[model samples]
Target chain A: MNPISSYLSSSIGRKWIVALTGLGLFGFVVGHMIGNLQVFIGPEPLNRYGHFLQGLGELLWVVRLGLLAMLVAHVVFTIKLRLENRAARGTPYAVTTRRAATLPARMMALSGLMVLCFIVFHLLHFTAQKIDPSFLALHDDKGRHDVYRMMILGFQSKAASGFYVVAVGLLAMHLNHGIGSLFQTLGLNSAKVRPLWEKGGVAFSWLIFLGYASIPVAVLTGVLK
Target chain B: MNLHLKVWRQKDAKSAGKLADIEARNIPEDASFLEMLDIVNDDLTGKGEEPIAFDHDCREGICGTCSLSINGVPHGPSETTTCQLYMRKFKDGETIHVEPFRAKTFPVVRDLIVDRSAFDRIQQAGGFITARTGSAQDANCLPVPKVAADAAMEAAACIGCGACVAACPNASAMLFVGAKVSHLALLPQGQAERTSRALKMVRTMDEEGFGNCSNYLECEAVCPADIPASVIARLNREYTVAAVKDGVA
Candidate 1:
């Protein structure tokens, strides 16, 4: 109890909480992108993929519950730390020149909030199929869930696709700062390897953006249909 | 060198502060930044006016007492303390905006002088070793690796300057705490209270109203001592390990 109290009360402890949970979400994001890329393999494989996920049965729910917990903790601790950071600066400088904080680093909390909203919207649109009830019961020719058709139809709408692209773009910026910062938070950042981690983070974020954006772009151009 | 200076002016902590424009003429290029200020103060005093108040001690950069944020850069544009900054660094007609180190924990005692005793409180929290002084240990008896010794010395080089807080967007004292933590944690003498040291110092830092480190790295860039941000990473690592150890214990 003493340890828990001290740990929770410390700022560095909160940072560790944010970094560890962020790592979990980052892994899920990568796994999800790869699974969605299966759409390029055609309806049978993609539908089978979705079916295989459901095949996990109760384990799938456990993972979902775990991710939800992680998301809640990450968001809560982040906001708390952000508020503390703001209060720490009692007076703002009359003139400011950026010496260290990059644009992406400065926008981290804002982008994080937007990404949170996007995650909820995405789950409603795709996972629950509640956003568009028309896609809820559709099946492919193989009698499997027509996830492929739903994706095509979902992206066919210019507004939805536009919203998705913007959301993913914000997600990319979030990752651009979050990834390199994780190394710092974990104390793995060394002077020798810091630049590699920083550049690698930007590269990884752009990669995720290109992968996520490819789906909507393909569907909108009638390539996926 | 003739320079236009906008220096922050305040009578006391309760009073409001403003930047006062004053012209400095015929300053020697070899004169230090503080010396130039001295000349200006002398002229004001001669004219029966109150001289601008600022902090100073050793003209040498060793003492962390001298502090000024020159033109938005802490300790001026040079990679040294304000006392060590030379007049030659500025153009003849250039205008310099000088302000005190700003942070919630550090309140202004007057113009260009903030009460940095928050640092003393943080240091007192756990920045020392409590070894018995029965007898001096032979240097050969305690075998420290060269790399570890060098790193410890680098961390120990911190002069307790508040520039890191002034330079930080969040006004975090992580770099200062990081330096002290690494300095102690690296040495065998500092092993007795390593776990508790990390916990107490961090808790005190938070209580003192300092911000959490966000990896901005501005502190390292503006640091006159050049204490690297990697030290801060080490602080995070040490704190994490300590917390986990305490949790299991």
Candidate 2:
């Protein structure tokens, strides 16, 4: 392996990967949020958007594969970095607090892992369509899987809606740190632009969380049906 | 004023360390932090107990020798070095907890004394100017910009203190190594060996088993010399460019 590649494989390399893949995931979240906002336009438009995505077919699969690769790289790098940090520090002092980190930056890895689990459950509940065959069986007049109806029915249970709300909350947290971190990694952040980036990250994260969570919340409340 | 001290005590490099509580009364509040420790050691010696061994010299704070992790913060709550800290910072009757710099690469030699010679070894690996002796050149032979000179001076201000490592969550010495590398590599006199210098220093830094930087910024927060973490960023860029240029990447 090349020395720089080997260096990247080292602990520092892991950080670079986290920063890079984190930027990729942040872009994905923004795009996903925008697409999801169509739900506010009612089922017809939302369903059309879902169908368009489904129509991508092989391209969609490529995108999914790319995302999976990014996720695996992110998680693997995180675990490696965490283990290396622990080994180097030996034992920590008793007092640990959030003072060392900004609110969202501190729980980034934890929130990211939580969001990862939620994503898995989300795919099973909707994408994989295997967890609930009855939901998968529903179809619209256009012979499309009634993704809108599935989403509505899926959130009918308070437990399911509540889980989604928390998941979105965690996703927001992950985005808060990740968005700003991407700029830092790219060497774009400076004293002049850093505060702007920080505030912009917070705004972007909240927008994404609200956009995604609104679908579940609206459906559960019978406002979308 | 009276003070309660909890000092970490270890017999040797391999020994398990513990906090040994001791009481010292009527200490002057104006004493430097190390002077307070000195008083405690004097009391211990008077009692026929072995005085706690800690590293300190040139109590004015330039030497970077007085290493202590006070109350979970490296060199106490102040941004200054341990030797520069004053006894007045603590309240009367307050308990002061002191420990050596904790990291895998910094093994404890005794109470509040760790062998930081690993840092010296790493520095020795690739941290000097290669300019040949007595090769006299005119001062005006090489005209360098003032901004570059200032940047180099700022980077050169690093005193080789392990505070960057001590304050870092992963105990990364990149800030220290980067400063050293940047100081020399930025100069017109040092550009001839920049690629080789960065590669050799970075490899030596890793070989010394220092952890990677996570960019927590704690090193900047606690650095007595106030060396910026930006130097580490410059170091990363230099390393990448050098590695590529050298066909090592």
What is each predicted model's overall lDDT from 0 to 1?
0.91, 0.80
Q: Model 1: per-residue lDDT, tens digit, B61-153?
A: 998999988999889889899999999999999988988888999899988889999999888989999987887988898899998999999
Candidates in order, TM-scores: namely 0.96, 0.92
State chain A's TM-score for model 1.
0.97
Residue-level lDDT of model 2, residues B84-130, one tens digit each, is: 88889999999888888888888888888888887787677778767
- Candidate 1 lDDT by residue in tens digits, A119-203: 9999999999899999888897777789989999999999999999999999999999999999999999878889988999999
RMSD of each: 1.6, 2.4
Total clashing pairs for each candidate: 0, 1
Total residue pair clashes for candidate 1: 0
Model 2, position A135, has a per-residue lDDT of: 87
lDDT value, candidate 2, whole model: 0.80
Candidate no. 1 TM-score: 0.96
